[model samples]
Target: MEKCWDLNQLYLSFDDPQFSKDIKTLEKRLEDMKSIPCQDVHEDNLKSYLEQFNQFQDLVEKIYAFISLTMSSDTTNQDALKYSSVIETLLASFADTQARIDRWIGQFDLSQIQDSYIQEHMYVLQEIQENNHHLLSDEGEKVLAQMKTTGSSAWLKYKDQLISSMKVSMDGKDYPLTEVLNMAYSKDKDVRKKAYEAELAAYSQVEQGVASALNAIKGEAITVTQLRGYDSVLQRTLIDSRMSQKTLDVLLETMKKALPIFERYYRLKAEHLGYFQGLPWYELYAPVVESHESYPFEKGSQFVIEQFYSFSKHLGDYAKKAVEQHWIDIYPRVGKVGGAFCHNLHCIGESRFLLNYGNEFGDTVTLGHELGHGFHGECLNQQTALNADYPMPIAETASTFCETIIKNAALKSADSTQKLFILENELCDCAQVIVDIYSRFLFESRLIERRQKGPLSVEEIKDLMLEAQKEAYGQGLDHRYLHPYMWTWKPHYYEADYAFYNFPYAFGLLLAKGLYALYQQQGPSFSEIYEKFLSLTGQMSLEDVGKSVGIDLQDAHFWQNSIDMIKDDIDLFEELLKQNS
Candidate 1:
């Protein structure tokens, strides 16, 4: 009857004997790596060095993943926080020690190291070479590592604290911002509007602290990018993401062109919701027609598994296993987080799902979505630890693809009323991921540009947000109901770890659609291709990775094909609206 997940499956606790032993072993191995003298490292020593480095990296990844995943599930865990901080300190020390070796390695002739493992380690060697200029002497790197604890990292934590403690009151009841915000999905229109207003108003209380955090994080990020000889923050992110701005540029262009198609869907929604001018922001999520049905846990579980089996027996079987093995934590309770997520326990080759299942038709789809993510990781479990983590674009591909299977199945099975609701949910999510996300991309691009001139004021940020909404939304949302507090609550804006984090979503959605389209054409044969594309995402360049499935990333046509698929949906949505209106 546990409503939330139990991490004892991953570790009894961070202080568990096994976890403690791993931490000790990890530290000792890192120190051992650092003990190798710079002069002693040569081409002949390459094999030994790699064997040691891989072991150290593997352990570090395992330990960090365990602690971080635990904290995300329940950030209130003090032991998890302590472990994260301790591991971070360990990583910095490891990096500092490796810096000395890297500098020496950079000076050595890499051609002399002929082993395939050494050759593949070129990425590490290349990174060291690229960073050699900014890397201070070993002593300086060690010292800077200490300063960063109080620098950008501290600012990030402070911002997290500021937001987490925020409260908003509505109709004389004080509620956490998360709870108040969830009211937007209520069946009552008045509640959604009032919640929207309160949510916007509550943001002003912490605007200054949040703005300061954005400034500190991005400011340090910009400085570090320049200091490390990066062309820009965008470039650094792409390098880390294994994606290119060129691919993103193609994706953005496709997004711009696809807006009008979505505008039509919004127009239809406005007509349905009784909007005279346009659909209001609060009403963007308004219920047009209800599916008016619910599925209890057992039946809902069977439906998803049964529908998924039609696509491929492998996928269906996987969903069956997820439900049967108690891999999912279903049902909502107080103190549990609001959103659903799927965390892959790669070491054990399983996944844990956290859901606030309400037995609504939408809840069934949410189950489908998270289970889809679990299957994505299941596909990856066969990969080496290093290859299991994919970049952002492909990360959502499998999940979204799985969702499509469930939704499409429901689409075919439902009565017209139910079908309308199911399709509206799909279209609404698509619209947000496409249209609203496009607006965010525009806002962040201009924000970064403006931030370079000086720190943006609260007024200026609002103005920028509104401008982006106008362009992306066009005639869809009423000017009177736009959300300017968007940048305030979206955690993506504050993290300099990735800039322009908006477009990967549009990329993933469109890419998945295109992939889904191919699957529809080829039938069961497409699953093999889909699985191959997913497998290659970790090691290959975005374009090269895509090429495995015959996708050309730089070509606007590939994106256009995906955009056209959505337009087809927009047309169907309008046709259905007419039938029901």
Candidate 2:
């Protein structure tokens, strides 16, 4: 099987004739859209406008996704970078166009629309109307959009460049930052320690630039959110997430209650690592019981396929097709980014995944997580481009649910040591999504609050990061070993548009767990319900989506149930550790 994904399905290369043709076609479409005379909201006017606009959107998605996926796989691809810039500029120029449509749509009492196509898109229409309240005047929106090209957008680009170019010096040799960061998973204590130190040292080269980027991007966000009349950045994020404060309040409260359990797991991990105080940050990712099992690419594929098949034939077949059809770009190369992500191209109805595969068992699980994202795209293929766009929180649901399937299946037949290893891996992830994510949430809240006054010094950013870590990790981590340069590397905090990108991870994991609980009770019959949920993710509010599956997202009891599931795993891990010891 091919190790690299084929983007030929999108275009043979950036120089493809169709690629250029699409750019021209997109320009024409934008011009045509601009020429469409604005009329009073009537069934015909609305339907005609939406039909043309949705088609425009689909083409734009295809063009942008092609450029983005190309850059993600090879960041130094000059053509990809150039085209991405072109597309961003074009889209920024359209901000006023979009705002005008939004304002027009806002004028209509959407409930009065009787057209079938309009009825089909009621949710999208309603969302546009809702967001119209927050939009500025045409000139104002255009100015903001143009300024952002240099402001947050440029800063994000700079941050990516800094990280991509960063190299760590270890033992008189240079290693890429991604390779050194991956050493965190190494079983060799010396390697992990040295890598951690080198990693920290490398940050000095880009720390000030990154801090400035953070300050500028967040300051921009604060300015814009207030200009848009949002009470705070978090409130804007919640509105964008289509989630209410009540739901967030309950989820966070439940997470607070469950924090100490993860703390206990952290302490247990510290004990396993032979640390008397707490697990040192360097050893946080250290494997508890080493498993000799290595899953090479083919072996990993087979394992993921088998586990996915056990869930249902449809899911199993989807996994098989994704691998056989060159849907995945597997393995890391120089200049390729670290970590894994699945980008779904709705226009062409295919998803491309980027993975930095090492022959670790966790890599196999990562495959499952990303393919779960692919499966989500598959379920939404039948929907329109606008309707297929799900909110941040629900975005991770299918991926995490698929991850649960793989991990649970792994644990079923494992020996004592393997069980302990698997459980530790699972608990390790949960702790991050639960406890560490809470730290990020706290840190971001404080960062935004502080960024308002003025640009913070590097020391101030590091101090805030450390303070947040102390509060969230509590005594779970040795105070002396906390990572301060974390704010420099994570891309989440740098996005002015997508602020507070941390908590959605927690929300996604917990919601997936809750869904998994339902699957346990309902069994194979749950597959239909699961697919339905995935399909509606783009159309429904998160609360309504949960209600579709009889879940009450605002109920603390529901979130506590998800936490209880993790606690059970922690309990098993402790028992297994004791028995093995």
Candidate 3:
């Protein structure tokens, strides 16, 4: 019944005594961690360090999540902002200590470590050893970490502030930018066009500032990656993502080949909508078939629970618990960030989700997607803190897998008109993941290439975006109506550490589709294998994760098969549209 999530599980308030105590504890642990002797590589010493590190991580994650979740729902919360900066500074100060520990661990061959405790964490320890190859000198590591607190971190916060506070004016009234963006799905053509125009106009007020933030963050990423001996930012991202270059190349090549199929779906939608040139960007999310049914929060949540139940009891139970436990922040408000995300708090064995719900069927699908992320977290609960952190590419597996479950279930029960709406919505999402995401990958690749030369101006950034759109979308989008200011608002580009966040969504979608195919072939028994795959994600390479469930990520055929599934959906969508017409 509560619209807002209950943060009482984290803390009653920032001023809660437990919150203060945890901060002090985190500071104390940092000191203890710094005192660990790097010269001693014995099993006992390593075990002790691991114990202390896990404890320190637990305290830090608790404090950080409380502050971040607080700030996410209300960016103006000054206390949350202050504490966030404090926690970041503390973590940055520990970079030298971490670097020393990593270097020390790197010296030992895992086969030589005989202790059971150390062996239990062999995978993560091996990862640390591998990552040590990229570490700078201790002082350099510390300096970079400390500098980033003021550098990329500050810019990211500023960007969030600018976007969160921005308002779009239309029809003599001002609306939160998120509310207007959600209007893209409005059944009324005028509403969609007006919202799109107003949304674009509103960015001008913040475009220059957002552009500056983008340049600073990206420039920092380029410099840092080069310093770490990475050939390019994308290389560093692949290493951090626990993915290989070959895997990425195959995935992208497959998606690139499938782009024409997506473009065809786009052009067909345009024809249905009476746009002869191409689908206007504003009309991208417009509903073609009218559905009398509405998906208010209660109805949507119930639907998600039911559909998840159809998959497995464990998944069904997780959704029910998330809804009943007040773990979701469920509406758009002035200071709330746009879009949706599921933050899995391994420290508390729970996950928190944020959504901008608007009672549309698309919103229901988004709910299913985020809840899928939560289920992934649920599976990882058995692992220790460090072992629970999975790579970005594999991160979307459970969420997108959950999305497939919800969509398939809905399609089976819908009338012909509703089927068209559902099928079209699914195609639109797939296109965004496959087609729009490719455009983003191109834009960011080019953006980084140019940022290395110098900071890109606002106009130059917009031009790069348009160029990428033209190339990726081809004739699928109207050139005149393309969204030029897209870079200004997408939160993905602003994160200095996580460059190339676009491709992972495509990776996840295709991988999930592959896994979903396995589920179809294996039936109810496949649930165990799926859970096992999700559980191992945090501890294994993505290729290994796929292989755990009999899937090969590096093979071109695996990715191509996934794309063909989307192609099948396009065929069904076309047939449904014809029947409706």
Candidate 4:
């Protein structure tokens, strides 16, 4: 009912007495955890430790989520920033404690035991044990953890500031970077081109600072991974992501094969824009068929509810409840972060979404996407806190699947022009998640490889970005107009822990597409099984989770089927272009 999300359910404000009480409780619990006779290994000790650890985890997540979510909505909020810093330091200390517990647990063979709690928490404990080989010495981990606050964490804060505060100059006027970026979707060609140019020019002011932050952040990731004995940053990320190299190898290989299809779509878009050579980077987001279809917030919610109900009453109910309960922070304002995300608070059995809504068709799809994530949270809410944490790649599955449901439903009801517009929008999304993401993966791989030697110069970073774009986009984009400073603004690149955040998007998109295709064949019964699949995400490996649903994540054929689905859309888009022309 309200425009902003109700964090009051979590906490009224930072100044809330409860917030302070929890901070003290968390600190005291950290001390209590440290004092646990963890070295004294036995069933009782393990059981007691597990119970205390669960409480500690829930408390810390509640406290930290409140602060982080607050900061995301208001980047300049001093109270949020202060609490965020405090929690970061506390969590770092907490990580050291967790590391020690992990080591102690690793020395035991608790997996052989049949305790109910152990059975319930088998995956969580086993993962810690499996990663014990990579765990640094307690002292080493503590030092690394402390260093990160000043290193990658600080860099992340700095980069967030640079982008949030950045003002793009256009035609002797200034606009927020987000406002300028939104112009790329404008129907006016000059507005898109000018916005692109202004965005590039604006980056010059913060390029040096952003470049330094990236170097520092990535440099720390490289150093920490090496200290932990990881084979590489990517390998470390895959391990943390709970994905296997075999699965990544297959997913990437499929994506590589599908590049030409996306390129064909891009070139067709270019030709439609009257650029025979290729689509200029600026025009990549330009709407192909201008539809005046706009869904205001209320209409958007109703439409999503209807479409989701067509798929499953459960999903429809969740969408209706999220809207009615004020779980979403809709619309954009100064200092709020760009993009959209659903933060699922399993600790509270609730989810909060942030959106930069602009009353466009894409905005409705984004609402579907984020709510899909919330629906995922609803599924996982039934699990204990320890088992509710799904890996990054599988994390995208439900969200993207929800988007597909709504998009397909809309396409079915639209006229020819609106259908063309919707299909083109879908293809554009698939292109980014699949094609552009490939370039980002390449860039990060090379950047990490080279970052091992030393920090990269700004010029070298730009060069790497261009080289990756050229390879991934090929002639789909006019080489001359490619974004060189792409690495600077994308928050994914600056994340120290999640090295290759790029490909997981492609993984989620393709995997969800495959799931959607399965839904098409199986019809209504598929919805029940789909929720079951989401529930297991927190408990199983990506491949095993796919196996549960009769999908082979490691098989090229499985991914290709999803790619072929996109290819069909691309074909339809091209045909639509001709019909419209």
Q: 1-581, model 1: which lDDT tens digit per residue?
A: 34555556567776689999989998789878877767876665765776777667567766776776666666687887888879877787765776788787778677666777667556556655665775677776677667667777787778778777888878988778877777877889999999989888888789888888787777777876776678888887887677878988888888898888898889889988888788888888888886678888788889999988887787889998888767777886554566789887666777888887888888888888888888788777776555565777677777888788888888887877777888899999999999999999889878887888888888888899999999999998889999988877788876765777877788888888888888999999987887777766766677888899998989999999988877877788887888887
- How are the candidates ranked when ordered by lDDT, highest leading? 3, 2, 4, 1
Candidate 2 local lDDT, 454-563, one digit each (tens):
99999999999999999999899999999998888787998899899998999999999999999999999999899998999898789998998899998988999999
The residue-level lDDT of candidate 4 at 12 comes to 93
Better model by TM-score, 1 or 3?
3
> Candidate 1, residue 575: CA error in Å?
1.6
Give the winner by TM-score: 1 or 2: 2
TM-score for candidate 1, please give it.
Answer: 0.92
Global Cα lDDT for candidate 3: 0.91
Among these predictions, the greatest TM-score belongs to 2
Cα deviation of 222 in candidate 4 (Å)?
A: 1.7
CA lDDT, candidate 3, residue 570: 94
Error of 4 at 108 (Å): 1.3
Q: Candidate 4: how large is its RMSD?
A: 1.8
Better of 2 and 3 by lDDT: 3
The digit string of per-residue lDDT tens for model 4 on 51-130 reads: 88778778988998898899999989999888877887677767777788888898778756767987788888889888
Give me the displacement of residue 86 in model 2, in angstroms: 2.2
